[model samples]
Target: MHDSKNALSVQKLIADLAGIVRIMDQKDQQLAPAINAPSQSWLETWMTAFWETLCREWASIDQWRMNKVLLLVRFFIREQFGLALEWAVKQDPKLKDQVARQLRVLEAWPLSPRERRVPDGLRLHVLDVWTEELAGQLSAAQKALDEDAENSDPESKKSILLSLAQEFMEPVRKISREAISKGVKIRAKEAVKLAEEQLSG
Candidate 1:
């Protein structure tokens, strides 16, 4: 019975994650032009709203559940980071050059002594979104495992988590890659048009 319940919980978490990804994708589509606007700071505002929406959705889940879901969230963030960068560059070619320079700075960004820290304030906000709502999930999972050692296998749970993470990543990756590809082509066309205008003028 406990095994079945745990499996259901895992499935629910997967569905929830999928829902979050879908909502984010929709929000991105609705806000893409604004997010990509060269003169606006809409991306930061959108990210904050996204994080807040995620917090509201997962706020009730216990820490252990939140911790498990967070693995998938991290995967989502990594993939979205690439997608967001691609879309940003697509919006403004000048930013492509600026990003190249920033990459050098990122490579040498100083780190504090903390073992697992996201030094950037924005990334710290992302981390806080997860930690604030699910801070007790890890401990709860550990306690549950301790209390039911015979029924719970930590290795098996780890395997399940990994499997779910991959499942969550694949669709998002596919959609983001498609969007980025389309954005790149659009930007290329725009660049050609701008060049032609300058040459004719």
Candidate 2:
């Protein structure tokens, strides 16, 4: 178990990381129109360098002894890092397929014996949404989820179904206030009902 001091240090590091991501996002929004390709190219270069350095450092760590850090990093991969990757893909549509594959790889990282448990309901949902967001199509994520559902054991099936509920609970709520397509909204609601019935049984 992590001592409080180590836990605090991790929290501080995560906060700093969060700040960096937000700054990058804000700059992207502010300068995207004026500088266009050059700005995006520069940002992509920086992001690539940062990711490579991070991967190297990650490899050098003794993650088994750092369970708390490992769990936080896995959650970061599922959420913030995935969002950053999705943003990168948005800035370059050609990279969509590549980033999607990488995101899936990161998503699966948490399931390694190092983590000792499946991703919980909320993280599963966030990962699925990022997949959809990156693809600019919910159908892609839904299809993948359906395939997983088909292949999973009954216990894993519950996690898959819970993700469906999460899809509706969060994104659907925001989409409701936006001018989203009717078909997408209907599909999301249906997913929620499907999750409810299956999980209830």
Candidate 2 wrongly placed segments (more than 4 Å): 1-8, 39-43, 63-65, 81-201
TM-score of 2: 0.36
Q: What tens digits encode model 2's per-residue C-alpha lDDT throughout 80-168?
A: 43344334423355344334434344333321212223333322333334333322322333344456645445444434333433432
| Model 1 TM-score (2 dp) | 0.29
lDDT of each: 0.39, 0.42
* Candidate of highest lDDT: 2
Candidate 1 all-Cα RMSD? 21.2
For candidate 1, which ten residues in a row score worst on lDDT?
A: 106-115
Candidate 2: global Cα-lDDT? 0.42
TM-score on alpha carbons, each prediction: 0.29, 0.36
